[model samples]
Target: MRSKTLGKIVLSLISVVSLGLGAAGPAAADSAPTAGAPVAGKTEAAGKGGPEGIIGGETADSSRGMAALHRNGNFLCSGSIVDNRWVLTARHCLYPEGERIPDSQLTVRVKSLNRTSGGGVVAVSDSRVRTEHDIAMLKLDRSANAEPVRLATANPKVGATTYVFGWGRTCATCAPSTVLKRATMRVESIDADDVYGGRAIRTSGLNGRTCHGDSGGPLFKLVDGQRYQVGVVSGGNAGCPDDSGFRFASTPTSLTWIQNVMADF
Candidate 1:
């Protein structure tokens, strides 16, 4: 089993390169490309390394309220804006199983395709973790002003199409992507468990799969041209880009908790 600590260690190492690049300052926001739209059958070769990014994926054309999480200026994980003041992500991104992470050490960049720049960075004022589920919610210090994604009230059925987004590595040893990337996948098992053994949604890569740095990223299901977040990237097996073994905590399993947390904010 991929332990929760394994996920943290992988992400920590990935952050080294990110910290160096971030020190140089944010790059100019690249013009919105027409390619951000979801492609039906796009794929890329996986790079050799441990795990990271969407192996065999394409650059995301739209941010769709995605947020790049950073810890002490180093890229950490990915998240989604669920409200003007709330960002939802994996609990492991915040800290270990039982520990608490200080709100001051975390920040989220929202409304941008580029993680290093081109988005508003907001400090976290408060956070809540659903320990049993491996999911967490961060309360932004102020409104993000970015659009929020709707949380699904139920899990997608097996074989349902889904999409995942992140700024993780493209290859095993590659640095994390500066631009957001996404992959097409199919729900493989709604009965799976996350790294922490929380109820999770397992997916098989159709054209791409979630890897390192993708922790806490959103797994979205499209309905009526609308995007509903059905899962949060938790962890996966080591063989990324292999078209199997991606797992995300099922959002519907903890919808009531999410609502209560949001209501308190």
Candidate 2:
């Protein structure tokens, strides 16, 4: 169950406290550099060695329209397909405030755990951002032709086991991995006072953590063996790789907005 009603003042305070937290570390390059390759920001550990959840948690499969995005060979962020041509992610991945990057600069990969290989690739033709909750959608120039992941309709119960997927840095100071990763987390709370209408889902890592470059990744709940994406990676504390902090995300609390955006597109 969710917490009691929170006034706008409390919600504003929570939003302020959550700000400045990053989704993950900066992205890593897609290929190994020969020499003098520009090293991106540290912490792109998208399953560098082991995932950021329960230490021995198994890696997740890529059958659910999982995608990793890149720009000029540098890993950008992670996302999932919600429609034939629409990809869901965090707004910060493609924009700075109100500015949206041109679609020509972005590429999306699907159907592969290896970010560098094995997935079908497509160019982004457009993007839409909902800054209030840090959620966004990208329109692919062509269909990925893969089945999109199902979105969760109801609120995930507190204490329920959930999973997160991404291509973020393996640890706080380590380089970002090109392969996709998954970790298990437990629902901690619902930010009933979040400025975005209490859409924030706070989750505790079981064994692994979400580090750099994991922004826009998916938080999923399994229902009777099927995957339902319930949240989008948003912000968390800086104590990554140590497994001591909680990560927050945008969830179906804004389902109406998500549906509205998809319909508009």
Candidate 3:
């Protein structure tokens, strides 16, 4: 059966304060190319925001290699630093209606968990994406000066706990969270294909769900007490404040695409 194709609805990149990037960012990430549709289910409307609280989760102090992709100072989507000069994010994040936004129109903030304050900011020089999946690789004009995140060498176990980090909304109708929010979810399945025919890792979230504005956010798994990125936030059926939705992303399946692109960057 064909899964319902829920468009990639990345939250509007609205900022609380001016981060000096100007106000020319894309209005919203609504029409951009996306990873896939929401996990199997009829669409539901709820408090659409990312996860919160430490029910075994906590507000991350620093994601080390995390980066917030901004357009004209407005928050767009989340990305993971893969190399000193490259960031891995959802391909949909770079285009709106299939037209690629120029690198001059974007900026990447790194190091700080807080999106508005305390981070190294740099202009993007270039971006590379493949149509096979919803992943993209960005080249920074200069090094981010922060350590890049490690890619998982193997898929995570179905029952293992994983963490998601993002600056997505705190509520469906609320503004984006200023500080990076972190939540812990259990891996429910691996290698599940989304509506777009892309393989994804599905996770179960109770109090913590990946919501709007979290597109391309990193899903990390602890390997020997070290954080390794195993997935990227793609989409979910409903928003937050309502705790009954599953989150899915391109991870183990994306590793090859990520590596091939990074090698050329």
Give per-model TM-scores. Answer: 0.82, 0.75, 0.78
Q: Which residue ranges in model 2 land beyond 4 Å of their true spot?
A: 1-57, 96-99, 192-198, 239-241
**Mind sharing the TM-score for model 3?**
0.78
Instruction: Flag clash pairs in model 3.
Output: 47-240, 48-172, 48-239, 48-240, 49-240, 54-57
lDDT, candidate 2, 83-153, per-residue tens: 87888876656642235557787777777666666657788888886655567788889998877888888
Residue-level lDDT tens digits of model 1 in 1-265 = 3233334212221232334434111111112111011100112232344322456666677776688888777777778888889989887777632345688978888877777777678888999988667789999899988878888999999999888888776765565667787888888899877756678888887777666567778888887867788888877655343667677888999889999999976
Off by over 4 Å in 1: 1-18, 23-53, 96-99, 239-241
The TM-score ranking, best first, is 1, 3, 2
**Residue 215 displacement in candidate 2 (angstroms):** 1.0
**lDDT to native, each model:** 0.68, 0.57, 0.60
Indicate whether candidate 1 or candidate 2 has the larger TM-score.
1
Instruction: State how far residue 63 of model 2 sits from its true place (Å).
Output: 4.3
Q: Which candidate is the best by lDDT?
A: 1
- Number of clashing residue pairs, candidate 1: 4
For residues 65-148, write the lDDT of model 3, one tens digit per residue. Answer: 778878777766777888888988776666643467788878878876666656678889889875645677889899888788
